[model samples]
Each structure stands twice: as structure tokens, then as C-alpha cells.
Target: MAVALDIVHDTQETYRKVLTSMSRPGTISTVIGDMDNPFPCHYATFLTILTLLDREVYFHVISDGENLSKVITDYTLAQETSIENADFIIVPNGTNEEAVIDAMQKCKVGTLEDPQNSSTWIIEQNMISVTGTITLTGPGIKHTTSLHLDITAELLEMRNRRVQEFPLGIDLIFTDPVSLACIPRTTKVSLDGGVI
Candidate 1:
């Protein structure tokens, strides 16, 4: 096991960086900062899990899982559960459209009265860049922003279907080897080179 990362300070700082990405929607940011990431997934993904998961929650991995569920439990004290009940759904590979959408279909989209009970998805990608054409607008954006994430348009369309209901939706966090970007439920995403 790698013995790096001052849990308290490192986790706090990483949490802030993650929060910044989430709060700002499409803004790209880095996290975990060379803290000896020993997991098979990205440093940002591992560190984000460290920051958000704990004993009270459960997590489930979809593809390229590679025993990460147990590994996460070893670090976060969070247990592994069925996809439908998972608080955090980790997808190390987003190339499988069928499985990705299948999991998303099963994942919780909180009710109108208890919207806070929804799931948070942590998905790994090739990279998170600023040059892509997908437009993002809403809450934290001034006018608009764009990202170049390699996630499938079909998956995004699925997200729109699931989240368009407002309060009841899932939040997305995409990470590369070290960087991450968030797409909160409230953010409007468009791919036709125009606002949705």
C-alpha cells in the first residue's frame, strides 16, 4: 500500500477543488495534487471518492471495476451495495454505452420531496479539456462554457432525460489522470453548437 497523503489536510484541499468544479459546472480543475495515487483509476477519481465517501454510504462500480469497490471500502469505510442503492456510482470506463445507460437507469433519481437522496456518478474519461464543443450554461456560468469530454452523446442524452425533471437527478463528475470537471443536474448541456 502507498503511504502518502495527509488524510486531513489533503482531503480537505481536494474537497475544495472538487467543490469548485461542481459549483462552477464545466470549469476544468485538478485535484489530489501528486499525493501518491495508488489506485488503478485516476488520482482525481480516487481522491474525489476519498473526499465524498464514508461509512454511511455505499458505492458500486460498473465496468473496468478491477476490485476498486473493496479498495474504496478499505480507504473510505464505505460499503459496496447494489447499483440502485449506491450513493456513489463509479464507472472507470465510459465506452460501454449499454452498461453505462443500464446502470444509470437503475441509479436513484431522488423524489421531489427528497431530492437530496439522489446518486452522484464518478466516471473516468480520457481527459477533460476546454476546447470541446459541448456548451454548458446555468447556475454558476456567467454566460456559457464548453468542455471536450469523450463521454458518449447518447449517455449525455440519457442524463438530460434523467435530470430534466429538476430536483430529481444525478450529478456527474468526470476525471482524467489528475483533472476533473462536474456537470451538476442544474446545468444545461447542448451539443448542437447552440444553447439547449
Candidate 2:
């Protein structure tokens, strides 16, 4: 039992580091956990699944394949659920704007009393940059900050729509090969819409 507790603690620590990295944007972080797989999912994704998933958590995989589902189930011991019922939604790549927005609409809002029960969406980006002209504001920002992303305009529109829900919409974590960025529902984003 002691060993099990230690493992859980370690997992939580790893996740905390990852979350901190994401919250800061353009930052790189490493995830040291118990994942033994050598293929497909990256270390960050593996750590995320290990930390956030369990028997009580339901995850939706939008990447399209049994391999992802198998990997998630084997690593996290989480149940597979549809978009409407998922507590966490993972998109291995961040290109599916329509699907992501549709899934977001289906996620539970958890009411005003328990907003933490709401769903979180994880999307993997090809790369993350700190040079884009877009600015972000809200809880995580001291004032406003700029970030560059390889995101589509359609996705930004969807995010804007989601932002209108304020504290009730799904939060986003965008991961790249070695870094991550988070845009919580509370964030207000403004895009330059310029060519990059």
C-alpha cells in the first residue's frame, strides 16, 4: 500500500510540472512517470493520461484508432466514453476544429457549484511559438500576453464561441513535441488574423 501511494504521489508531481509548463506557455518541461510504452504517445501525453485518468474518469479519444484507446486504457485504467460523457477529451493532433467544438458542446458543464467536474480538452499542436501577434487575457494572465500557435482560424473561432460561456466551458491544453500551452475558458483571446 505504501508503494502504491508513493507511485500516485510521483504521478501527481509529474502532472503538476507539466501543468505548470503549460500554464506558462512557450516553456519546456519533462514528465517523469511510470509509462513503459515505447511507441506512439509522447511522454507528456502519457504523463497527462496517468495523472488525470482513473476508474472514475471517462475519456474520449478523438484521434481515430483502436491503438490510442488501447494505450490509454492500458496506461490509465480509464473507461472509454463518447464525447458527450467524457470528463477528458484527448486529440492527438489539434486539427479537428468542427469535431472539437461539437465535442465541447456535449461536455458536462458541472453547474455553478462544482465547475471542476467539467470536461477538459487536450489537443496536440505541431509546434508552439511565442512570437505570434495574438494576445490573451483573463485569470492566468497578469494583464495580457502574446502567443504564437499553429492553429487554424476556424479553431480560433470555435474557441471564441466557447469563451462566451466564460467559466462553464471546456478548458484547453495545447501540447507540442516538447512544450505546452493552456487556454482556460476564463481566458479572453484576441487574434491579429495576420499571415504567419
Cα TM-score per model = 0.93, 0.79
Candidate 1 local Cα displacement, residue 153, angstroms: 1.2
Per-model CA lDDT versus the true structure: 0.86, 0.68
Model 1 steric clash pairs: none
| Candidate 2: regions farther than 4 A off | 1-10, 19-37, 193-196
Model 1's number of clashes is 0
Choose the strongest candidate by lDDT: 1
- What does candidate 1's lDDT look like per residue over 1-196, in tens digits? 4447677976898888888998999988876455566687887788888999999998998875478887899999998899999999998854476898899988998999999899999999887898997899999999989899887677888898889899999999998877889999999999857533
Give per-residue CA lDDT, model 2, range 1-196, as digits (tens): 1122244775787678666755754334545434444536655565666777887899888866537877778877899888878898888764467776677667776566777777787777776677786677666467767777777666777767755754566677766654556777776777884422
The most accurate candidate by TM-score is 1
What is residue 150's positional error in candidate 2, in angstroms?
Answer: 2.2
